[model samples]
Target: MKITTLIENLKNDSQDLINESGLSLYIELDNKRILFDTGKTGSFITNAQKLGIHLEHVDAVVLSHGHHDHGGGLLPFFKVNSKAKVYMKRKAAGDYYFHILGFNKNIGIDKKVFEEYSNRIAYIDRFTEIMNEIYIITDIEEQDLTPRGNKYLFAKEGNKRVQDKFEHELMMVIKQQDGICVFTGCSHKGTPNMIRAARTIFPSLDIKAVIGGFHLMTIPMLKSFSASQEEIQAIAQMIVDENIQKVYTGHCTGVKAYKNLKHILGSKIEYIRTGSQIYV
Candidate 1:
């Protein structure tokens, strides 16, 4: 299996988006093309075209959650591949804040986006295998022991305060010989918590790599907003313990936070920017 980021805000190359967040990718099982989330703009399509990647070749598309930064590109994707299976939580069709460093990005997928392709869509709220060696983590809860990372994420249904509990998100783990390469789209499920779930749900598999957004970077005003350094350290330690050899994270990872993460992970962490491609 080979995982790459076809579209993103930042990139290793000079052409990468500086601060803007964009497209993400998740290819699994050697041939299965699983696109996790679309970037915040139509550039995802443009980037795909630039890379000579055909949207029609994707086997499935999954919206990690309902943020425009992650789900917005679906509009262009829909226009190209109108018949692929799109897996997402049913509740993602509501307005939510893709909160970030001192800004609120509104993201919500309109029902019309999938109205024509409803027959090929699957809304998952539990653990399910979409294909051989690919599993989706759904409605994950916070860890009972550890207490770091973002604890404020929540969901609202109509007028009620919904416990985000990371329920609207989904994660894909691709089994590999050395271990597994995990793909997440803006891990609202808490980075550490997602890793733990990956271990529990797929105890037989080892996580070799992780590639996606870990919305750890919080509001710009650091005076009381943002995940603590202790939490970051703990998460970093967990990754090392799990033996994950490589990491490609960006988008919601906040430039500052990820910089710290890179230092901690050392040679094990590799940030994937826009137009970045890696053979895992």
Candidate 2:
């Protein structure tokens, strides 16, 4: 498997690619091309072109959640790829929002945008295999103590700001020669929860690595209003306990959170930025 960071929050100082508060990964596995998430703008497309990646040939596009930062590039992608099938949870079409400082903003995928390509979407509600060794995992069952930093995330239900259940959140797992590598979006449900869900699907494989945002990062506006120190430590320890060999995280996984994780996981944890590539 070969993975390229098409877009991320950081860029290699030597590379001229643009960076944003989003995530997009272009993955090649078993001679198949998969566009994981589309980041937040056309910057991903620009970077992919510079990297010589052709979007028209991607076999599939997997969306981990409904957050705009992850799916906002769909508009530009649709203009390029005419054949790639988009895989996402059915609930992603619902109203989702980010509530902060007494303000609620629509943070979900644009329903109107999805309607334009509805014929090409494969909205799923349960765990389903997209192809050989590739699967879209849902219904995550949390086996570890993952801090719920989702008090601000909500889904509208009859004029009520119901806390987001994260039903639209899904993960992708690839079975490799060594073990399984998990790809997540924001991990609003938590990385441990996603791992536990993956284990249930492929119980025999070791969780080799996890790549994406863990969402355990601190808020820039409300520095004192994030996951507790104890919670962060527990998550770091959970990765060690699970024997997850490596963790490549960025975007929402704040600098402070990465520092905490590095203190425990050391070199085992890698910061993924734009222009990063992982092979397994």
Candidate 3:
């Protein structure tokens, strides 16, 4: 499989790419082109063009969650790629908010995109094999070590907003001959939990690599870390314990947290940026 970072929070060294507080990956696997996420805006489209990625020919699009930074490019994507079906968790259209400093800010995807492109969107509520060897896992029950940064996130239940359980988040697993590659958007549920869930589902397959954000940033505005050094070290230790071959993370995984992880994982971990590419 070949994966290219279409959009991310950082930029590749000396590369002409648009950087945003979002994540998007272009994947070529099993003769199919898959778009993992759309990033926060249509800016990723420009980055795709620069990288010589033809979005029009993309075969499938998988949204990692309901967050705007993950699925905000749906409108522009539908405008270009009319044939690809965009997949997301069933409740991904529900209202989501970020609560901080006594303020509630809407941070969910645009509901109109779901309404207008209803025919082109697929709502997934269970373990589904979207294509040969490509699977989407939505039932992540292992909640060990979920991100502390998620404390500020909430979702509407009725008239009241409650803490988000992150049921709207999903993980993508691509099963290859050697092992499986996991793709996550922000890992709001927790990276360790997601990995455990993936292992539970595919206990026979070795996890070759895990990719995407780990959501370790407490406050982006203040640039503070949510996970303590010990917590970050534990996560890094978990990765090492699991024997995960490689980890490509960025976006919500703060620089300090990444450094903390790097201190332990060393060459096993890498920080991905806009225009970054990986082959597995």
The digit string of per-residue lDDT tens for model 2 on 1-280 reads 8889999888999998988888999999888999999998879999999999998899999999888889999989999989999999988878888787888788888776677889888997888899888989988876665545677788988888898988898999998888999998988887777877887788888998899988875452253336677767776876887888889988777667888889888998988889899875
Off by over 4 Å in 2: 218-225
Per-candidate total of colliding backbone pairs: 4, 0, 0
Candidate 1: residue 242 Cα off by (Å): 1.3
| Prediction 2 TM-score vs. true | 0.94
> At residue 184, what lDDT does model 2 achieve?
89
For all predictions, the C-alpha RMSD in Å is: 3.4, 1.7, 1.1
Q: Which candidate gets the maximum TM-score versus the true structure?
A: 3
Of models 1 and 2, which has the larger lDDT? 2
Clashing residue pairs in candidate 1 are 10-274, 22-39, 102-220, 139-167
How much does candidate 3 score in TM-score?
0.97
Q: State the lDDT at 169 in candidate 3.
A: 96
Models 1 onward score TM values of 0.86, 0.94, 0.97
The lDDT of each candidate is 0.70, 0.85, 0.90
| Candidate 1 residue-wise lDDT, 1-280, digit = tens | 6665767656665663333465468464566777888777667777677767787888988778876677777777878886678888877766565344455444466556667567767888788888887777784667632332344344566886444554567777777677877777777667787888888877877788888877765532232326678767877988988887888887767677787888898888877877777887
